[model samples]
Target: MIVKTSRPAARLAALVLPLAALAGMGTAAQADDWTPTSAIEFIAPANPGGGWDTLVRTTSRVIQEEGLADQNFAAINVPGGGGAVAWAQIARDTGNPHKLFATSPPIILVPLAGTSQYDHTNFTPIARLITDYSIVLVPRDSEYQDLNDLFDAIRENASLSVGGGSAPGSMDHISIAGVASAAGLEAADVNYIAFSGGGEAMTNLMGGHVEAVITGAGEAAGQLGPDSEVRALGVSAPERLGGPLADIPTYQEQGIDYTFDIWRGVMGTPDMPEEAVAYYEELFAQMLETDGWADARDQLGWIDAYQNSEEFGAFLDEQKEEFSEVLSELGLIR
Candidate 1:
C-alpha cells in the first residue's frame, strides 16, 4: 500500500532545506572569507604596564582607530605562568577564529625552562610585528665602564647578580645567560634576579638593590633620555639602534659576538580558521602602514621586522631549537 505524507511533514522538510542552505552559506563564508563580524580579542598575556601589555594595547588601539577592523579590538590581560595561562586558553579555543594572543620569546622560553605548561605548537602564528633587542644597562656613574668591564667583573665573580625585568626563568634571565655564556662564563654560574618590569628594576638599581640590568632596549632607552640618570652599556643587536639610543654601542662591537632580537608577534588558537588568520595578517599589515604604528615602534625603539605566518612558523621553530640548547646549557632543562 502507498502512504501519503502530511502537510506538517512537508513544511518541516521545507524548513530543513533552508536551514541546510544557510549552514552551507555559513561554512562557505568561514572558509577563505576575510570578513570580520566581531571585534578580535587581543590577549596580552601579561599584566598591564608591561612590555607585552603595552605592545598589544598599542596595536589594538591603532587597529580600532584606523578602522582596520569591522569593530574595535579589545585587549584582555591573562598574566601568569609567564604567559602559560593565555597560551592554554588560546590553545583550547581552536578554530575560534576571533581570538589572538600577543607573544614573544618569553612564550617559548617559559615552556622550555619547564616553568610553563603551554608550548609553541599549541597555537598558530599570525604575524611577527617587530623586533625588540636586549640591552645591558648600568647606573650613570658606575665604575663599570663598558661591556668589557662588566664581563671582567662577571669573570671575577660569577655571582655578580644581574637583575632583569622578567621573572627568573623568563626571557630576561635567558638573555643574561646567553650573554654570560658568550662572555666565557657558564650559564649556571650567572646570578639573575627578577624584577616585574624595567622601571622597577631601574629603581632597584638606583637603590643599590642590583648591580646591573639586562633588560629590553625599549625599557633602557628612557634611561638615556634627557634628564635621565642611567646609561645603556650595550645593545644585543647586529648593529647600533637609531634615534636617542643610536650612539649606544653593540655587544659585538665591544668584542662580544652575540645578539638577541625578541620578535613580538600575534598568535591564534590551534586550528583557527584560515580566513581569520589571513584577515588578521592583512589588518595588521594595514595597521603597520599607519603613522600610529610607526610612532609606536619608534617610541618603543623597536626594529620593524614584519613577517607572515610561514616565515614566523619557521622562525619559531628555529628559536625553539636554539633555546632548547641554551636552556640545556643553563641547566634549566636537560
Candidate 2:
C-alpha cells in the first residue's frame, strides 16, 4: 500500500463513502417505523348495541371515512363478567399490538368488585376519547317522577330491583347506588339487578322485571322520546345535556348531590410496544380533530375529553383512588 492516490480520486472516494452512510441510515429508519400489517381486532367487551360496542363501531367507521389507517378495524363482541371475559382474553395475548378493546369505568370498577382478574394496570392505555353521562330510566307509565320518588319507592318496597347493564358494584350499580344513597337510602340496601347489556336491561324494564335502569346516556338515546317506552328520571350530569337529552333533568337539579361520568377510551394488550401505543395515541388525537368525530360526538351526546396515553394512565390512577374511596364507603370494595 505504498502508492499514494491523487487528490481528485481521494475526494471522489470520500463522497461515495458518505453516500453509503446515508443509505444505511435510511435502512435503520425504515426498520424503526412500525405499523399494523393486518386488520386490527377492535374488541368491545360487551354485547352488541351496548356502549362499548357502539363506541368501537362508530370509531372504526369514522377512522375509515377519514382514512386514518391503512388497515381495517373489525369490532368484536365478547360479553360476560362485567367486562371480565374480554379482559381475560386480552390479557392472554400479552405484548400484542394488534388487539385493542374499548374501555369505560368497568376497566377499573370490575376488578375493584372482584369480578375481573386484571385491572387497568394489566393493559396499555391508548387514549381517553370522550365522557358520557349516566341516565336513570323508568317506564313511561311508572309513577316515579324523579330520583327522590324512585328512591322513596325502593326504600318503601325492599323487593324493588334497579337493574343495570353492569355487574353488581360496577358502573350502573354504583351510579344508582350513589344517587339512592344521597336520597337517604343505605347504599348497601339499594337493590341492583345485573343484566348482560343495556338493551336487555331495557327489555326487562318493559317486561316489568325491574323498576328502573341506569346506563350510559348514549345507550339510552333511542328509548328517550315521546313515542319511546322509557322516560328519563334523572341524569348523572352536573347540567342538562343538549339535543334530545336536554329536557332530561339532572340529579343536582332535582336536589341530589351526585354526578357520575362514564369515561370511554381504548386500551391494548399488556406490554404492547411503546411504538404501537405512540401510533394509536397520535391516530386518535388526529381522529378527534376531524369533522366526522365532531358530528358523532354531538349525535351521541358525548362530551369532548381527549387525553393521550400517558395522561390517560395518570387519569386512571386518579380515578382508581377516587372510586376506591367511593366503593369502599358503599361497602362494595371487599
Candidate 3:
C-alpha cells in the first residue's frame, strides 16, 4: 500500500524561500554569543561503525583536535527504527542548544514512507557536511561482470533479490531503483532485501544469499580488495572517484544516466534558538576548513559539500520533493 501524489513546483519553491531567508539573516557576532558552556551531546542516530556514527565521531574528533570548540563534544549512539528512535528523542528535547544529531537521506525518505512520525521538517537544520555515493556490488566469483550484466539478470527474473542496509524505501534501495528505472526496467519489479546495516548486507552477499548489494561507496571500499570475495559493479556518482575507488566506473560512464549521493549533516532539535543555530553553523563551517577535517574526509571517501543552516534547509526541501517523485515512481509512496 504505497502512497502517491503529485507535488507542484510551487510547493517546493514556497518551502525554499523562507529557508533561504532564514539562512541569510544569521550573523557571526550573534553566533559568538551562544557558545556551549558544557559538553555538547553529539547524537549519532545509528549504531557505532555505521555512516551516522562515523560522521559525528569523526567531526567531533576533528573539532577537538583542531581546537575549534571550547567545550568537549560527546557522541552518543541512539540506534533503532533506522533513526526514528533517535529523532523522537531529539524532538522531545526541542530548543536544547547543546544537543545535535548526524542526519542524512533517511531523514527525508523514511518519514515519507510513513514508517516514522517525524521528518526533516521536525528538526532545525544546522549544516550539511559531506556526501558519499553508492556502489553496486556482486560476489567476486559471480558471472556478472558489470552493472548491465546484473540488471539484465534482474530484468529477466524479477525475483532476483538485491540487498541493502536500510529499509525498502530508503537510501540503498532508492539508489538501485533510480538506476533500474533509468535502465528501462519497472522499478518495483526488482526485489530488494533490507538488512539492518551495510555490514550485514555484505555478509549476505558473501554468503550468496542475495544476487547484488547497493551500499555506500566507503562501506564497499572497506570490503573490497585484490583477493576479496566481492567486486563493485558500478557506483552512483556522475563521475569516477579517485584513490581506492578510482577504478570503479560511474553508472553514466557505463551508459546509464543515474546518480545518487548520500549527503550527511548535523541537525539540532526543533525550536532551537536562532543564536544556537548560528553558533553550530559557524562551528561546522570552520570545522570544514581544518586540515584534520580534510584528512577525515579523504579517509572516509567523502566529498566536501558544506552548506550552512539555511542552505541545508533549502536543500532538504528539494531533496524531499525529489525523493517523493522517485519513491512514487517505485510505488513506495502512498
Candidate 4:
C-alpha cells in the first residue's frame, strides 16, 4: 500500500535565525544574515527509498555539504495520498518559517484528482530542481519486442496487468492508462497494482507478479544496469534520453503520442516568513551548483531542469490544468 500522513514531529528542535543571507528580490531585512540556525525539516510525502524521499535526502546532503545553511538539516517521511499529507502540512504551516516541503508533478495531480484537500495556490513555490522522464519496463526475457509489442498485447487482452509506484489516480497509474487509451484500449480495462515505492514495485515486476511496470527512468536505471536484461521499451519524453539509458526510444518514436515529465521541486507554506522562503530558495540554488548534486543526478539518471519560485509556480499552474484534463478524460477525475 502507498501509505502517507501529514503529522509533523511532536517536538521541534528550535526556532532559530542565522546571519549571512543570499541575494534575491525580497525585503532588505529578509536578506540580512539569512541563515537557519535550527535543524531544517524537509518532509518527503512518501515512504523512505521512494523517488520523493531519495530526491529530498540527496538534496539535503548537497545543501549541508555546501554550507548552504548554517546548521544541520533533517528530513522526515510523511507518505500518503500521493503526497497529500506532506502538502497539507506545508500549506498549514503558513506561520512556520523553518519548514520546506518537497514537490513534483504529482503535487499538482493530487489536488486535481480531488485526493488532496488543498490546491497549488495554497503553497509558496520555492524552487524547481529536476525533471524526470517516465519509462516502460519489462522482465529480461519477456516476449514483447518494444513499446508497440507491449501495447499490442494490452490491446489484444485488455485485462493485461500493469504496475506502478503511485496510487490509483496518480501519475504512475495515469501514464499506463494514458498510453492504453491512446492505443484503443479502455483505461479501466487495464489492471494496475500500486506499490508504496519504486523499490517495492520493481521487486514485484522482477518476481513476475505483474506483466509490466511504468516508472520514472531515474528509478528504473538501478534495475536496468548493464548486467541486467531488463529493457526500457519507451521513455515518456518528446525524444530519446541521453545517457547510459540513451539507447531507449521514446513512446513518440514508437508512434504513440504520449509524454509524462516528472518535475521535482520545493514548496513552503502560503504565508511562510519571507526571510524563511528566501533562505530555502537560496539553499536550493546553491545545491544545484554542487558536484554532489551532479553525482546524485547521474546516479539516479535524472535530467537537469531548474527553475526559481516565479518560474516554477507558473509551470505548476500549467501542469495542473494539463494533467487534470488528461485525468478527467480517463474518468479518474469528475
Q: Which candidate is the best by TM-score?
A: 2
Q: Estimate, for each residue in 1-334, the C-alpha lDDT of model 4 and write its tens digit.
A: 9865434532221211122222333458556557776787888888776677778888888877776677766899887777887777777667676777777777777777777888778888888988888888999899987877887887788667788877778888888888877766788877888887676677888899988888888767676767886888888988877666778888888878878788888887777776776777777887888898898788777877888888888988888888878888898884
Model 3 lDDT per residue over 199-273, tens place: 678788989899998888865676677988889999998898876788899999888998999999999999899
TM-scores for all candidates? 0.83, 0.91, 0.86, 0.85
TM-score of 2: 0.91
Please write out the lDDT profile of model 2 over residues 49-168, one tens digit for every residue. 779988999999999999999999999999998899989989999998899999999889989988888999999999999999999999999999988888888878899999998888
lDDT of each: 0.80, 0.91, 0.87, 0.79
The clash count for each model shown is 0, 0, 5, 6
With candidate 4 superimposed using the best TM-score fit, by how many Å does residue 98's alpha carbon deviate from the native? 2.2
Ranking by TM-score: 2, 3, 4, 1
For model 1, the superposed segments whose C-alpha errors exceed 4 Å read 1-34, 197-200
Residue-wise lDDT of candidate 1 within 198-239, one digit each (tens)? 555667788887889887786466558757778788899899
- lDDT comparing candidate 3 with the true structure: 0.87
Task: Output the number of the lDDT-best candidate.
Answer: 2
For residue 225, model 1's alpha carbon misses the true position, in angstroms, by 1.2
